[model samples]
Structures are given as structure tokens and as C-alpha cells.
Target chain A: MAEFWMSEIIKECARQRISLAEYIIRGECENSGSTREQVIEKMGKMLDVMSSAANGGLEAPIRSNSGLTGGAAYQYHQYIGQGSSLLGTVMSSAVEMALSCSEVNAAMGRIVACPTAGSCGIVPAAVLSVGVSHQKSREDMVMALFVATGVGMVIGEHATLAGADGGCQAECGAAASMAAAAVVNLMGGSDEQALHGAAIALKNMLGLVCDPVCGLVEIPCIKRNAIGASTALVSADMALAGVQSYIPFDEVVTAMYAIGKQLPAELRETGRGGLAVTKTGLAMYETLFGTPMSL
Target chain B: MNATYMTGSYSVFDITGPIMVGPSSSHTAGAARLGKIARILAHNSVKKVTFQLFGSFAQTYKGHGTDKALLAGILGLNPWDLGLRDAFSLAEKQNVEYIFEPVTKPTQQGWENYHPNTVRFLITSENGEVFDIVGCSLGGGKVRIISLNGILVNFTGESPILVTRHYDGPGIIAAITSILYQDKVNIGNMRVDRKRHSTTADMYLELDSDVTERVVEEIQKIPGMLNVILLQRINEDQSLNNIE
Candidate 1:
């Protein structure tokens, strides 16, 4: 049988008078043939990894193996410590945490792939920053993660998560959408509101291409994660204020997939289009590998 | 929804996790998984290995740390292991020799048909046993073993499996199935491959659950069975250890 759809999940939760997280927990238990405790324990371990990766880069300037991207997260952390962030504490911390996690990923430190490694920073940054600032307990954060997982599964099932296949709209866009849902859930928004948040986040990122400079995840990938966190927070806030998406979440995901398919191969992580082929981008590639960019 | 393209059920962890060390899940993490499975199939006795990388794997393997991750896995390190960064040194310390040969030209006969992110492992054991395994990283840290020892086969590394090399003859398949049925073990999928005019063939059985040592021994006793190896699912719970 096919897995349940987002609409089915929402209807089931409504019919059973249960929260979205509880419904997801039940679905996971049935689908994977694991006990409730086993699923929770696995999620708990994932949360632990996310927590560390969110902080791993801020504590030190960990450079990528290519020596291209590093120390930006640390610098941003120091800037936040100086209280100079234009965004307030919670949002600013989300951006910093997102940068840190992406940097750590570029350094090859361990991370939980929230949809994907390139987009890994967004979900943890959004959930942890908002949850911790509001004094939500660890269980509350884990529940928020379940909400994110639910949204990610729907998008991953219906659309795509790989940049090579669906561009950055699928990776960073899916991540921001998932993070928005988690943030909305953590703030006590209803399931509908959480989905609306996901819709808004994804709608904002439609058509974003996956053109990594030099074919590394270091260049635009790291900074794009920071922007994704900010977008998630804003989308969550909008959702909490009862703002509605013009299109449904599932429809939005389908649109994203269609647009991704329309993108040429050069823009889909090929490093031959968009910002990857800028004069400086090519120079960086040539300098790093002692060869001009090909293919 | 288009159910035609969507067939499998994904766990929450499958959507959110496989907690790993990475810059790219398909390149770094999935490549490591393929190497680890090859190591397990070779009984962890890899003395030398040659990774023939194709297409994307050949072009960007070094940038994505696919090379190090592959070696680390061959040296018995999981994708989440911190030692992945030092995989080259670790392989050297373990006396495991490795080479990365990038097959960039499509003119190489039969090579153009491989996946863009494919790697063929030519692994030699300490006792002189050799294995040829070809695998492809199917994005999101998922992998599939596409070939073994020049015999075409297909299986994702996500399942527990029994792999056998035996002389192709009557009653061999029935004998193996009877043993599994007696042990109450169900085979989820099965594939038998043999080259034309070849007496030796390979059988791959993807199992619903891991088989016991006793069952393996029973299968080993069957006449014409050259070798039987049980490969547990490589992406088990232990690989998700929290980062230190």
C-alpha cells in the first residue's frame, strides 16, 4: 500500500482528536514495525546530534577540507554576543545556529540530515532556538521535531530532497518548510497553522537553484542555510498570526517539483550556471584544483 | 498524488536522519556505506582496494570527501565516525592499500552504462581472496549493490541478506529454500544470476529477518554450495550514535 498523504494525516489527526505529532508517532510505529519507545529513543538521539551540530561550529573556527568556507559562523556568533544583531534574540540565535550547523557540516562534523545535509541547519536552528527561548522542555522540542518530520516526509514523498534532482528549492526550500512547521507547532499553533507555515516557507523559496561553486557545499550552500532559517522564523510568525497560504501545502510541493524538473542541468547542482559560473567562482575553482571548471 | 512514482514507506528517521558526518549525503555518507558493505561481504579482510569512480563520483569525489569516506568505511569506520576526516591516515595505519581510478571517458566499453554516481570496488583480502563489487549512491545516503563479481544483481544495502556462490544444477534452489522454510525464515526477495555456459552462479536472498548461524550452517552443508555469507543491514541503529 502507498504511504499516507498529508491530507490523510491531517484528517486522521482531526478524526481521532489527536495532535499531529501523536498521529505521526503512531504512523511511524505502524510503518516501521517499531514500538513507541523505540521511535522516541531514535528521535531523541537525532535531537542530540542536532543540538551538538548547531553549536559545533560556533565554539571554534572549523574550516572545510577545501579551505573555502569556515569561521563565518564563529564571526556571526561573536557579533551576536556584542548585541549588534538587527534581528532580536530568538531570530538572531536561529540564524547563528543555522550558520554553525552548516559550517560544521562543511567541516565534515557529524550532523542529522533534516531532509538533507546541505539543508540540515534550518530545522534544528528554527526548532531549538524558538523552543529554548520560550522555555519549552526537551520533550516539547522532540515533539516539534516530529512535526518537522511529518512535513518533510510529505514533501520528500511527493516532491524531492536531492539538489542534484530537484535543485536547492527542494533541499533548502524543503528544510525551511519543515522548520516552519516545527516552529509553529512549538508555539502551540494548530496542525493547520503548522502546515500553512510550511506552505508559506516553501512558497517563498520557489525556483531557488542548486548551483554550488566548485561543486562543493561550502560556498552558497552555507549562507543559504542562514537565509532559510530566517525565512522559516518569519513564516512561522506569519502562521501564528493567522496568515494563510494562497496555495495548499501539498499543491505547493507539487509545484516545486514541476519547477525543479523544468530547470536545466546546469542549474541543478552542476556548478555551470547561476552564481557558480561567476568570474570569481571560476577563479576559485581553478585556484583550488589547479584546473578550469569543466562540466 | 502520483502513486506510480511513490512506492516505499519512509520512517521518520529516513526523512530526518541517518545522523552522519558529511558535506554531501550521497557522496560522503552513501559512498561510505557502499564501502562498508563491500568490507562486510569480503569478511573485513581487505588488504588492498581499487575504487573505480564514474561520472559525478569521478569528477567531485575528492571535493565531497567521497574518497576519504570510502576508505574509512573499508577501514571499518561508520559514516558517523569522527575518524572519517582522517580516513586516509587510518587506512594507511591499518595497512590497507587503496587507489582511486577515475573513469572519465565514456569511450571505455560497457562503462558508459553505469550510473553517474557509481563506484566499482576491486578488493583483495589478506588470504588472497578477491571480490569485485559495483555500487551506486542513490542520493539521501541510500545505496544499491548493482553487481557482484561480474554477475549482475540488484539489492539495496538496507536489508539483511544471504549471498551464496554455488554450482548451478538441479535441486540447489529447492534445497536452500527448504532450509529457510524449515527455520521459519521468509525470503523477501530472491535473485539468481549465472553467465551463459557457466557452471558457477550466485544467489542473493533478501530476508525479512536475519537468519541464525544454525540456518547458515545448514545451507553451507548442501552439496554444490561453494560459499554462503550473511550480510546484516548496514544502516542499523548503532550507526546513529550522537556526536561527541
Candidate 2:
């Protein structure tokens, strides 16, 4: 039928110029009527859930019958280990699959542009980090999720969340959009600035792809999620600080969708392109699946 | 709530998979969303589903084993498809025909904020009935039920909620509520989805209990709300209730 968001909601910028994070922050300050403490408290609660899940509560879902998505996140949190410790939060919240770079985390997470499992960590990481920094209450995290859910609803309405459907661009890009929009909301962003931040965050990840090595959710999948977590936070900060995308959020999404359509199957979660296609990629595939993936 | 999140039209009652469990939610959940939509579109038995998957979803269908998930869902597997993961082998055993397309263009676009997750299915029956639904599986096992053919419906497994589209009119809400009220169904929270000025709109109501067949029918008869769907509470399908 008709796509949800045929029109752009925020502007898009071609280059990484200005403190887009700060821009978004200012937008939130200007619009959202919520107090700064309200935002901080919500961010804190998100950390509590993540911290608890990361430690040992994941099996509760399996024993209780929660679906795979929630199960995976909780289990992964447990799988990584947890604590009130800073590093533990960073590690568990991050999939850490594999990466070409090792940037020092300033308690910030980047959205790996797109790619679900890996992309999940960004928002959680940022929100939690902010929580710890601000000494906020845990009661607000759930509220933050409600807020995040609304923004996510808008993006989902307007864009794609399928790696195969669009590319890693959609996965990590969408996650970044969610993370940015969510963080901005928590930090007291107005709906206008929040949507604006999301547009910018998504625009940054215009043509990412889903290249899970060996078709497993490890490797780049894990690391990508962490990067996405951090990047989304950065974008959120920029939006709050008054960074503008030049082109609206809707236009960026359209461009991303267009780019996704042009992506080859090899780059779109086939385990045949990007990092999955290198000499190491072939070796990894041979090691795991017992042979090279045929196109 | 922003867009039609669960529209994969084809099988709410297709009998292809053996109790529909999964190796793939695209095959299983996406298929289930379609089946649910089918049930919503036509309260009658579905005849067929022109299931379609583009890009990598098409390429790795066999490996991911989505074919069986689709078959089983058409056959009516609740969310708890233990066999969902092995659906391909099972589908092969059952022999259901499915089509594949590699649309360099994705079914859903503009959501770089999430993942590029979209799967569309065109389900039809031999008796001249057809519908479509699309889904987005946002990583870590989360999925968004996008569009149901054209009847925009949005749902995530959050609550035991039911959403219906009705010809915007007075008394319809009260009439629909009476059916649930008679059934002793507890209304946890309800939101009438209206953008600005409302016409034919959607009503999203979360319930504290499972709806009975009668409740389903009563709400359906409420003059303006066209089709009604009872969305189960989050984790209801694959959760503790099915532990046995």
C-alpha cells in the first residue's frame, strides 16, 4: 500500500560537519517541556534493566516463554557478564564482533548503521552511560523506552528495518536513528528536534550493508552493534547541540531506501560481500560452514 | 502504532507446517502475521498465499529454512513454533510451492534507524480471496509487522491487544466495548488511533485476558469498525503458556 512516511521529517547533511550532537541537544532543549532530571532519570532506568539482564537474568525468559528477540538480548547480556562496573556495561551492551578500528569509548555507543543484533547495543549503552553520569533514577528507563518506542514507530513508519530489504544501512542506520531520537527525548528533546536528530543519524548511515560472516550473528555483526550504539549517541548529542541535516529526515530516508534498492545480494546479508568477502572472509567461512558460500 | 506494522497476507489457517515452529521468523512470525491478517481480512479459510521474499531473504530461504515456517503458519501455528527453525526440511517433506524474488529494491525503505528488515507476502485462496502483509525483523529477534496488504495494521508482541479499523462513527466504540464487557474481559489500556480529524480509524486495546470466539464476533458486528484482530500480549505465543 502507501508507505508510512513518504515525506522527509528532518534534514540530511552529506558530510560530518558541526556538532550535530549538540545541535540535536539544543533542539530538545527548545522543544521538549520535560525537565532535565526527567530525561536523566529515564536514561538511568534503561541502564538498570540492561545491567540486570547482562548479569544473569536472561534464562528467566526461556523458562518463562518470552520470544526470541527479548530472549536473545537478555541472554546476550548474561553471556557477556554484568556488573555495576563501567567496563562490564560497555562490554555486555556491546557485541564486540569484530572491527577494523578500536576507538576509545567515551561512554558513548555508535550505531553500526544497520544490522539488528549488533545494532541493539547502541541505544542501551548510551542511555545507561548517561544514567551513570547523571545519577538518575531507574524508574525512568522504562518511560524512556516508551518514548523511544514512539520515535521508533515513526521511523519504522517511514523507513525499513530489514537488512535484506534495505541493507546494513537500514539495520544500523535505523538503530542509530532510534538511539539518537530516544536519547534526545530522554535528554529533553522536542519531537521536532528528536525527529530531526533521527534524520541526521540515519542519513549518516546511508548505504551500509548486512555482511554477517559465515551467516552467523558473530564477527562483524557483534562489533557493528557496538559501533552503532556509540554512533547513535554521537548523533543524538549533535542534534541536541543544533546540528542540521540540510535535507529533511524524510528525504534522507528516501535516499537510503533508494540506495538499499540498488544494493547487490552479495552485500545484503548473503555473507558474500564487504568484510565477509575478503581472504579472511573466505577462510572464516571455510572454517565455520565447511566451505565457501556460493553466489 | 505509526504505520501498518503487521501486514503479511496469506495464512492465518494454512495447514502446511507441522505445528509451525521455526528456523526463521520471516518464515514463521512473518508468516503468522500474514495468517493473522488473513483471518482479519476474511474470517473464512484461506486458499493460498503468494509468498514473496526479495534480496538475501530469497537467496538463503533454504538455508534459513523459512519455507516451512511459511507453510506451518499458513497451517496455523501459534507463535510458539518449536519447529520454525527446521521449517525448510519440513516444507520439503510437505511440498508447498513458494516464490522468490531478489528485488534490488527492498520491500521497506527509509528506516536506517533500525535494520533493513522487510518481508512481503501476497496470500490468496483458491476460492478467490487475496491479501498482502509485510514485516520487518529488527535484529536481536525483534520484528515489526508492517503492512497487511493494504489494510494498514501495526502490531508488535507487546500486549494482548486487539486493533480494528472502523468507519469513524459514534457509538461504535461503546458497542465494541460491550462485547468484551460481556465476556468479563478486563481492559488494561486502550487508545483510539486518530491522527488529526478522525474518520475510519484504528482502535488499539490491550486486554488482561484472552478473547473468546464470541467476543471476536461481537466486536466485528459493531457497524463501523471493519475488521478486528486480537493481538496477544507480548510473549504470549512462545512464552510460558506453551511450556507443556
Give interface RMSD for all predictions.
4.1, 15.5
**What is the per-residue lDDT of model 1 for residues B1-244, given as tens digits with 9 covering 90 to 100?**
4211221356788888978888889999999888888898788899999999998899889889999999898888788887899998788788999999998777453644667889989999999999988888888888888877765666686677788999999999999999999988899999888879989889989998767888889999999999887767655675454345
* Residue A294 in model 1: lDDT: 70
| DockQ measured for candidate 1 | 0.52
Q: Model 2: per-residue lDDT, tens digit, A142-253? A: 4444444444544444556667677787766776676677677667776567667777788888888888665544446545656676676777778888887688777787
Candidate 1: CAPRI quality band: medium
Best by DockQ: 1
Candidate number achieving the greatest TM-score relative to the actual structure? 1
Question: Where does model 2 exceed 4 Å of error?
Answer: A1-118, B1-244
Tell me the whole-model lDDT of each prediction, alpha carbons only: 0.88, 0.52
Chain B only, TM-score of each candidate: 0.88, 0.60
* TM-score, candidate 2, first chain: 0.64
RMSD of 1: 2.9
Model 2, span B1-244: residue lDDT tens: 3221221221111101112222233433455444444444444345555556654455444434445445555555443445544444654565534455435543354222223445566666546666666666543344566555453445555446677888887888889888888888888877776656756778877687788767778788777767787655444322322433
